[model samples]
Target: MTQPPPPPPPNQPPPGYGYPQGGPNPYAQQPPYGSPAYGYPQQPQPAYPPPGPPQPPTPKGKLNAQAVIIVSAVAAIALIIGGGVWYSSTKDGRADAKSGDKNSTAGTTGGTGDSGGTGGGSGADKAPANTASKVLFQLPQPAIGADGNSATVDGSWLTDTVYAKSGFAEIVGYDPVKGTKLWTVPLPGPVCEASRHTTADHRTAIVYEPAMPTKDKPSHGCSQVAAIDLDAGKELWTRTVKSGDQAITLNNVTVSANTVAVGSTNGGAAFDISGKVLWAPKPTDTCYDAGYGGGEKLVAVRKCGAYGSRQLKIQTIDPVSGKVLSEYAMAKGIESASIVSTNPLVVAADVNYSAGDGSGISDFFSIDNKTGQLRTKISAPGDKYAAKCEGITKIEYCTKVVVGNDRLYLPTESHDGTGEYSKTNEIVAFDLATGKLDGQRADAGDGYTISPLTMDDGNVIAYKSPPYDKGGQVVSIDGGSFAQTKLMENPATKAVREVEFDMQPESAELIYADGRLYMSQVFADKPSTPGASDYLAIAYGTS
Candidate 1:
C-alpha cells in the first residue's frame, strides 16, 4: 500500500533558538508503510542477619526517597488524567521520509549516528496487517510479606525467542508467543535497579542488595552490580565497590560502548562487559556522579555543591575510561536533571521547581556533544506536556516520550475529547536544534491518549490508551505525514482492559515487538482482598 503525499512542514518563524538554515526538511517526501518500531520482580525471602551499621542521612539537596515518590506519583497521575492545555503544532509528518542530522538532505534514519534504534536494541515491533490482538498470558503478582513492604522488580526485556521479567528474587524467561516459562536466574536479593538497554547479544546489567532483608535486618543497602546473559538465563558475574566502611548504594546502572557504568552518591564506576573493573568510584564532598544515561553514548549527571546550593553538570563521557569528553553546566537553581537521550544530549530539568505540576521538568536542553555547548533549551511546561520524569535518583528515567528524527515527541496532557466528559490527547514534536514546535500533531482520536514508544526506521511506534470501555491500540505514526497506521488493537473486554489500565505507562515497563505488547509492573503490593487477581504483567499479540 502506498502512502499519500503530505503537505510541506510549517516552519516556526526562524526567530527562535538557532534553527539553522539550509537544513533539508524530512517532510519533503512521502514514506511507504509497514515500518517502525518501537518490570519488576516478585517474592519475599527469609529474613537474613543485620545488613550493616546505620547509614548517614540523605545528603542535602537530595529529595528523600519517600518524599519523591509521594510528590511525583500523586501529582503526575492527576495531571495525566485531568484536562490541560496542549503545545500547539505547526503541521503533519511523513513517516517513511528519511531523516538525518545534517542541515543537508542526504542523511538517513534520524540523527547522524543514533537513528532507528539505540541502547543496543533492534527494530520496532510492528506488523502492518495485524490489527487485532488477544491476551497471551498474565504473570501473577507476588504476595507482599507480613512486613507490608512491596518487592521491587525493576526490569523486563524482549528478544526474538524470550520475554524476560524480574521477579521477587529472580529473572524469569518466557516464550514470546506461547507465554511458556523457559528459565529463571535467581539472585541473592531483590533487584533495586535494572538497565533498560540490552546488548545486541542479549546481555544486560543490574543492581541488587547483597542479601535479603530479615525482620532484624530489613535494610540491606543496594550495593551489588552484575550482568546477566538473557539468552543463557544465568548471572555472568557479580561485582561491587565500597565506601569508607560499607558497600556504596548504587542508584542507577546502564550499558554503553561495551562498558557497564553504575553511579550514585559514591560517584561513578565503570566495568568492561565481561566483569573487569574499568574505573572505580572517586566520590568527593563537593561533587558526585548521581547517575548515567547510556546507549550510543554515555553521559553522566554530576551533582556538586552543598545542600541548599546545589548544581548539576551534564557530562558526555568516555564509557570505557570514565573520562569526561564534554560538559555542560546547568543554570543556577536547577539542582537536578534527567537525561532524555544520550547521543543527542537532551536533558530535562525542572528549573527551580517551577513546573509545579510534578513533571520534574520545565525545560529540555539540547546540546552539541562534541563541543559541550548548549544548542537550545525547549520549554516544556508541565501542564502542556505529559512526559514525566523521576529525576531525583534515576537520571535516565522518563516516560511517554521518544527522541528521534532530530525531534522530541511527547503527548499533550489529556484534555476533553469531542464528546462530553470524554478526554483525549495528541503527540507533538519539537525541533531539538531550534527549541521550536515542529508544527505537526498526531491526534489520539476521541477518548484516547497516545505515547511514543520509540523510533522505527524514520517512523514512530506509539501506544494509544483506550477509553473506559474500549480496546487500546498500537500504531505506526508516519514521521512526515503524522498519519497513523494501526498495527495492533487490544481487546476491550473488561477482563483485559482491567489489567491493561492497571499497568500505567509512567511506571510500567513495556515491550512491544513482532505484533506483541508486554506490559509489566516495576513493583507489586499485596492484594487487599483475599484471592483477588493481581498481575505482575499481562501480554497481548496479534497472530
Candidate 2:
C-alpha cells in the first residue's frame, strides 16, 4: 500500500490536520464569556434567569386608585403565570450531562437510537453567488473528564451527517444542516492517530490510548479498529491490534471496497468488511502499507535491496486473495512515494537526495488499475510539485489532485518556499490521454492560498482563508469551464487577532457531500451559560 508522508523530526510534533500546529488544548478550560482572546471577537453571552416582567406604572390620582388596584392585581397575576411558564421551559431544557461529562444528554441512547431533530433551519437549495455564510449550529468540545487525558477529536463527513470523536472516548454523529444531535456511541478507547475512513457503506474508526506517545512512554497499549454502520450507529466489528514487540504504534487505517487496511511502524494488516482477516502482519518485504488503487486492486510499496541501496517498489495486489498481481520499480532516484488519489491511482514520488540535488524536479505517476503498469507520467506544473509534502502532510493533500475519467485536476502554485501560497495559483485540468495540460486555467479560491477540500459532481470544493484572518470562504471550481463560485464564508463571528503568517492550510475543512458543504473550524462561538462549553461552529453551503 502507498504510505503517508514521513513523520516530523524527533524534536517537533506532528501537526494536526485541519488544526493549528500544536492543536487546541483539549484539557484547557473554556475561556470566560464576552472575553476576547488575542483580540478575536467574542460570542454573545447568554442571559440567565432572563429578565423579570416589567412592573406597571403606579396611578397618580386618587380617582383612578381603585382602577389602579384592579389593574395591578391582574398584572401581578399575569407576571406570576409568565414566570411559572418560563421556569418550566428552563427546567425542560436543562442539560442532563454534567459539567465535566462529554456524553450528549439528548443523544445519550446507545446503539443506533435517534436523538431526533431539534429543528433550527435548512440551508437553501440555491444561495446567491455572494460569499455570505451563517452558522448552522455549534458543537461544544466534549468534556473528556479531569483525567488530563484527552482524545484528539477528528470528524468525518458522510453525506449530510458528520461523525466526530468526542473527548470522552465516544463517537458522536451530528446533522450539520438541522443543528440536530443524531447519535452517540461510546468507544472502548480514544481514537488512533489519523485512523478514520468514510466510505459509502460504512465509516471505519480506530480507537486507542494516548493520542500521541512520548519518548519515555511509548504506546504499548492495544489499538482497536472498528467498522461503524453510519445509519445504525452500531459497530459492525472491532479487532484489537498491538504495536508488536517494538512498540511501534499503528499509523494509518484505510477502507476501500471490501477491505480495511491498517498500517503501523512495524508492518500492517488487512481485513475484509466482515472482520475476516485476509492477511496478518508481515515484514515490509511481504506486505507493508497499502491503499486502494482505482478499482479492486490494493497498492503496496516495499523496499528492495540492502539498507543503503534499497529502491522503492510498488506492488499491485488482489485485495480478496491477498496475492501480488504485478509489481513496478519506481525511478532509481525516487526516495519515497505517497498515494495522492485512490480513484485515479495517483502517487507522488519524493527525490532521492543521496543521488544528487534533485531541485526543480517533481514527479507524479498514474498506474493502470488492471495491469499495475505505469500508465502515465503526469507532468508537474512547471517547477512546482502538485503536492507540497515536505513536512507532515495534511489530509487535504492526500485526497486532492484528483484523477477522473479522462482529465486530471491538479493544484499547482507558481512560487514556493514561503510556507504559505505561491504568487500565482491555478487548478489545471490535464488531458489524461496526451499527458498535456489543458488550455483552460481555472481561478481557485484566495488566489494561490486556497486548499482543495473535495471533488463532487465533477466540481472541486476549494477552501481559502486570508492569512492571519478569520475571513475564510469555500468555493466551487467548475471542472470544465474553470469558473469559480464562492459557496460560503467563515461562520465565526470573531477571528484570531494576532497575525497568523504561516497558518497551516488544513486548519479548517470545507466538505461538500450530499449536495451540501459542511464547514468545521477550530475557534468558534461560545454557548450560553456559565458552565457551557465553547463549541466548534458548523456552517452550511446552500444550493
Query: What TM value does model 2 have?
Result: 0.62
- Residues 1-543, candidate 1: write the lDDT tens digits: 998445323321111212233323211211111111001222232111112111223435321111000001100000000111112111110001111112211111112222212221245545656578999999999754565467777688776678888887678888877889999987777777777665556667788776666677764666777777777787766766555445666777787756767777556666666665566544233466777887779888987664334567899987666667888988754656888888788999887667877667889999999999999999999899988776666677777777888899988887777754556788999999899998999998876778887777778888887766667787888889888889898897777877776676544677666777788877666775878898988888887
RMSD of each: 17.9, 19.9
Clash statistics: count for each candidate: 25, 7
TM per prediction: 0.78, 0.62
Q: Rate the local accuracy (lDDT) of all candidates.
A: 0.65, 0.41
| Best by the lDDT measure | 1
lDDT of 2: 0.41
